[model samples]
Target: MALNGCSIWGCAKALQPATSTLSLNSKHDLGKCGKWRRCCSSVVNGVESSFQYADRVQVQITELDDGFHKDLNMLPKPLTANKFSSSRDGTKLCVAYKGLAGAYTEEAALKAYPKCETVPCDDFETSLQAVESGLVDKAVLPIESSEGGSIHHNYDLLLDHKLHIVGEVQLLINHCLLGLTGATKENLKFVLSHPQALVQCEMMLTDLAVTNIGVDDTAAAAKAVSLDGRRNIGAIASSRAAKLYGLHILAEGIQDDDNITRCLILARDPILPETNGSYKTSIVFSLQEGPGVLMKALEVFGLRNINLSKIESRPVKRYPVRLRDDSKYESIKYFDNLFYIDFEASMTNPNAQHALESLQEYTTFIRVLGCYPVDKTDISC
Candidate 1:
């Protein structure tokens, strides 16, 4: 049955957290007769009180005549807090990271949650979707690099997904040149890596005078080189990738600069951070075009003594171009933009609430992406 635009399971509502831990109690009717029903669950101190969302993907097709019944299994599920607990806490956490098993993103996840179960995904969206679909408890995806700049694709995905940012990790990246055991750097005719990695190691690649090819990710490139068994081709990836794929590390720290990647930890629910600890909040907003309009919106934070950590603008995809008419001139066309901001404060802070309230008066749209604790661990490779 065609179920496009169908609002099944009460619009597939995102689970709302009621306390420091989530204790959801939502019920939705199934089919026309409502005979086929499933009991929704609540999480108390990381334990499931009812149905286990992760292991219930199978549904009987006979119930499809009701339309909503057949499609109910497609809705996203929430992760229990227990699955996020650390090994030290005596609970095993299942976390997802982009790329192969040995990717730098996996290192970041292990650093943040020691002994946690790491699941590998082919791309960033897959990692996020895993967390949303109850396949994993959290996803650690790179958002920015110290030398290569912001990962713009992940920023756009953060806007599209309903997952919340629960934490972050900044890992000092050490890129390595990998090749076959018998391969040498002097004999290599070509190198492969992600676009950002290739750019970061431009000087080194130029010194070798080899053609550089861009791939989906660093670890994937390393895996390809290992499987291809080409003596003249090498890959730029993490040292861990070399070990995982059984490739030789021809060169260590190939990237010209000491690059560090900042990764964000996403989950279905936000953590209740302590008021005494340092926190950061991320928000996205849009404003009407006019003189001093942008200035007026920024003034809210400035006047309240709240510090903004980052600000970026992206063209609105749905309505990229719009016409503006001035009383003194003819109508002019311009691209509409959505502004993303990261600030230093928690949502529980009074000043932050007032700042957002004040900002609402001037903005056409505003959303609080997440309020998460800042990662302050001193990192070393």
Candidate 2:
């Protein structure tokens, strides 16, 4: 169990070949009630022939039981590779994004690592699963969009999964209105895109009388409009998506706000950035029920001069329940909760550690999500 790199063939090689080749033996049938039967087939190669020999060896063991009622014992289970290192080293990072192959998420990942391979998933949660199950080295998920606001599912997923947030990327979101060849705004009657895209372009679309259809993703909307070959339908998506799908650009910068941007989190094993600068540390914790529990929790950060960037409360689903005193209800519910807080200090800072230590007495659960370099690039002119 040393922490050396995982061997790809260790599990396969350790299992007894006879156990893998077990077959039903027909000769020992107890008048059609026997569970064992024979397997007869020609071996294509020496490896398969060796497997057959292993099967014969296993069949002989079952035939040795002479008594009608005999006790049986199962063999020990096989050992598997350590779950953490399966997707490390040269393994490709499987990334899931909400758009097509050439979308912003993919672009950011490529920007981070030029040669890294990418896997396009349908949504954000699927990307998390890919990383959680060791199928991907890391997941790049969008947590906030500058113009549209925060992506809440990703924040919730961070609390649900043990995967760490190691890095982050800020990508400028450039919105484009695309349509098929010969399509024009005057002829268009409907626009299709994701809900966020629709919201971003709300004012731009208001001037026109086109009906808005919310699809699953931006690039998918573009592809649909392109494939449908409709001259009256347009899609709100990225300029790259328009070019990839062979769609014509009807207009550019379609978002109501020009400062649209998205904050993406790089997660696998969370680590503080190497470079020094103003840092932000995200932590999640839950407090025991008390009169001043929340106030005391906030005091820890305030006392240490640690500025909180963001704070939100969410109910903890796993705690025990109790009866309510309210006259409106008869049933009781659990009061467990989780508080997500982002502070303007790195985990490396003494004040940050001291704040957590002070709050630990009242906190039932606590976890540090990540400490990353602040995105100080101003979008405003």
Candidate 3:
């Protein structure tokens, strides 16, 4: 049972998408079986193998065996284009996004998967549901915005759904003020857009001396003006939305800064990235309550030289507050939390595998969200 200088490989074969629960009996050491691999990857014997997975993880264990090979049931699968409705030619692929045809989500989808068909949904949840149900090959939704910060809801939604983070698309947002052909800034009375968009362009809206109105979406804002035949109400949307809705670009790039929204591409299955390329693994873990426990958990990565990219702590809503007594049963409280971390490492590397093994020993629960190619989008714009 000693892990001082030895590593054990408890390899779980790549599973079909049905069973996502990963089981690792405590009897085995960290390297034995960490979790699930994808279609092309698995840990064989003590050999660390390359895997492609639509990353997502759970569960308990029984006791000791040197070469234990109990099925961990790391439920995962790869996204195949077969999920899309076959056209007469059956060649073009389709992806889903929220909002109208010209909305930025759709733009990100098309930009990431050029020549693929882009389908629109009424809201963000629908896009995720569509991907989960295989109604579309993939779905794209924004996770973070540079100027305003993270979209907290999407982070929560990532846990609510079972889709994998197959890819990432970072789009430079350039907000355009759209209006009826005859409408000008001076004549505009009200400006409408998604609340976030409105916030992003608050200064510009104020400078125009126009009233700001928050609506469902920027594209819808443009659509409303077009349908109403209104000249006074303009929309803060994209130039593409302006063209699609038959509006003029009253102003362009009005956002507070060169804003960027990092969008996640979700598919039923995870894609396997190159073994040697820059990659990131996202995981969520709950830890035991004790001083230095978190530091001990984090040290695993540091020991292996696996750099962490992002670490987010979300309050555990179900157990938001834990009651403690001062040995006198007086009221004392503590916050229960879950840590979501993103680290730079390919799971195929032995060092990365060892790190997870060490983490398994230190944390109460851990789940791998996905291991994906790092988005190296040049930020010069």
Candidate 4:
């Protein structure tokens, strides 16, 4: 692979697709399974389709360059001008989400914007790019899950693009164990689904004592299991996926716990939230190397009585490692990370303005990801 530009796709070149069957280690009929299947129908036309094709070409990604414009220009011409369907008039909102029609991301997208036209994307980057290129009005991103923790890749993607986080939606996941029409738990040998879903259903799968295989998307997993036509091969997905792929639900609500996935809404332009409304502002910042650097940065918020809902740190992509040398100790290396915080206060609040102003003194770099109204609606149903 050649290191050309900063785009993750540009850093590598495509190799020929492998024709060999993927082997699974299990006591059951693992040898009967074939190669992994990609769901191309999930893709739309235009640049996103080009991105999907490009993603297939390259598997390994190296250091990403600073710009995505050069990579965007390398793609082939779009199949059609209107990538989304024509039936959706200009009045309707078009939103992009990663994975097949029955995937959880699509569910979250619809929950956030009920009437929006949901566009299925092959990958997270494609979904983000779709919004960046004006192919869709907004893109819904799964940021954190109550069961599996944070989706770190999307946090990096947030910094990579110029898009703004406009809002958020939380979805209660109800994972189901699905199989062929006549397939049952006793005959099933292995279960397949997204890695997160697999983890969520760990206890249930362990009880069944079947081999677990991780796929890209839950809906795609259901589709693959249905397409494989093997009674032994089952999938852990949503009830909707079972219906969509013509698979039978062997078990329902099979998740180990009550899991909730919080998805972020992204747009090309930022939304101005009303000051009086309940809002949560998200910001990312890097502090100078010091013992109390992070603590001091947080003190500003605490002083203003601004409640922080969440805080997470991600390693700086470009500068991951930093050398630390102190007079008392030998030279050491530490991960240089950027902290992401979600505070329960609107950006329009005067207290928030003062907090941020005070925060600037302690931070080397800072950027507000978004300030949007909180999604307090009960969506557990």
Candidate 5:
């Protein structure tokens, strides 16, 4: 049960199952059924083989902890020479972020765990892999921006990865325009940053008559501009990026609006739920083709008095198209969608549990992404 630097494997015990018998008297066949058949498969080299293992098994619940660096093979990439280490000795939690120290992702990670050691990655996926592989105890990934709404890619990544959401942080975004020394706003001909940052500062860049060039990360963009040493290039990034890259700030708060990006803290294991705190439960579900199916699913929460803060849908990956009959001869095609909902109740709440149970009755597939405490930080600029 010790999760300290260990993986939580499924705890199961096999029980020799009993044979079945049925009666044919109106409702069943009398003493006709035999032992149930079961087989487990395994692949050796490239060949496959099957063997009967267990008929009955049991599973147990497990919680997350910082001691998870023992599973290097779980990493998305091969283990490298550089292993993640705590900034201090080996006591602090090793956290991962998608950018260098100046990136807002790093700020979010720090805000969530002020004393944790933060490691930077080239991209979001690397940070996620770091957590999954036990390179870091946790990862901070931005899920939504106040201006641009939900980051769809992050939402998809949530489904693609098995990592659990353990916490959340809302970081206020105040983007700054940074350029190399002696570079003025008027002289800047191109603005570079992540696509979202570029879009957020669209009007400002247009007014400055600078072409916005989308790049990987805002911090990386700033670093590029600084290294390029071009007066014609400015970067829309954070103030910290400017200082770290030794770039001059041409303008402050250049974003079209004051934004708050909501980040999800990811880990290999789920956090132990607390009953008496303000909490939110996030879930994704898919329903079969039928009228009022979605309505029936939402009604479970309403019936249970569970308030939903957000509900968004994305097209199901494999089967994106769904056909609908508009008329006898005409048909309409729509995307088969998977709904992600955030309800204002913890999973520990009986009402929330009942609501999800009711929801599953109508959904073909459903998953609870997380049930974590609500972030009440004054995330105002």
Candidate 6:
């Protein structure tokens, strides 16, 4: 009479079975069982009598109280891919960049994945959106240029979007001052290029009293000069751009620093490469209000021996309420809120996980942007 392992419809005693009969296959049937009805029936006839009734009703019940726990334990854990094997043939890879065919970003993407179909965007933000909307598999955007400092807008965009910086490419930026076939430095009165390009050649531009014009892109400026047949105008761009636009280079290596390089970040879905060297993980978080909060946040990385490559702070736009007793709320500036960071560590390492666990106690928001192999090559032209 003892149905120790028996369960009506394999449900736990804490759970209620269906009021209607549970049909198994076309013919077999498990009679109606309800929590209240079963309980009252059990109390009246005793537990053994209820088991006998269940047997008569032909209802199979699992006796295990931890049925849900056992079922969950039986399920296989999720598996993850850990290698950089090339995607299958006919598998399309979308790469977004802001430039013409021979732009440096495009060149870098081609160098990284020669078979990828490149999508040309008009601006960097557009490139970021292309990847966000799933139009592209990845986007290559410049983060810092050796000669022009950091691209601040892109850094802001990195924080604004939920995209990850999966990998990086360091490309040598060789600036060529290009003009019409017969145009020379002496005849030039105006120079056209992207702001960064113009900054890189500031010294060269100073030597020649040329009016610098800011354009959307260096290659686009070269195309404009070539199309307009500007005999007195020149463009500071790459040699490849001059060739593409049918312009002649009046002078090459015009950038102040001949070894100028730009760091390009490749953004895509979270990619965990199987075999990588010297990995770096980037994370962004904001700390809760308290004294020693910043120090505590930093100690997590320090204790784990994770090198902080770069830490930057941007005001959280949504939260603008400042705590100031004075009437002049605008005058008193306080950088109370900040985006704490950690860098240059592999996620697979236990120390990195422990560091994040430590960080969770103090931080209000935390996100791992990506874990990628470090590109440590001096790509100088």
lDDT of 4 by residue, 1-381 (tens): 122211111101011111212221222222232221111000122121222342333222122233312222232222122353334456779888888768888889888888887787767888877877777889989899888789899988876776778889989999999988679988888787888788888898889998887777888677667656679889988877676666788999888899999999998777767758898888777675568888999999999899999999987655455555465664544566778999998877778877877786666556667778899989665
TM accuracy, model 1: 0.73
* lDDT-best of 1 and 6: 1
User: Which prediction has more favorable TM-score, 1 or 2?
Assistant: 1
The TM-score leader among the candidates is 3
> What's the count of clashing pairs in each model shown?
0, 4, 12, 2, 9, 7
lDDT of each: 0.68, 0.60, 0.66, 0.70, 0.67, 0.60
Candidate 6 deviant stretches above 4 angstroms? 1-91, 258-268, 322-336, 340-342
Candidate 2, superposed: residue stretches over 4 Å from native: 1-94, 111-115, 146-148, 258-262, 272-275, 318-335, 378-381
RMSD of 3: 17.2
Which lDDT tens digits does candidate 2 get at residues 54-156? 1123211222222311111121111122322343465555554444555667776665566776656656666666666766667777777667566666776
Q: Estimate each model's TM-score.
A: 0.73, 0.69, 0.74, 0.74, 0.72, 0.69
Misplaced by over 4 Å in model 3 are 1-91, 321-334
Q: Which prediction has more favorable TM-score, 1 or 5? A: 1
Off by over 4 Å in 4: 1-91, 321-333
Residue 264, candidate 5: alpha-carbon lDDT: 93
Q: Point to the candidate with the largest lDDT.
A: 4
Model 3 lDDT, residue 177, Cα:
91
In terms of lDDT, the poorest run of 10 residues in model 1 is 35-44
Model 3 global lDDT (CA atoms, 0 to 1):
0.66
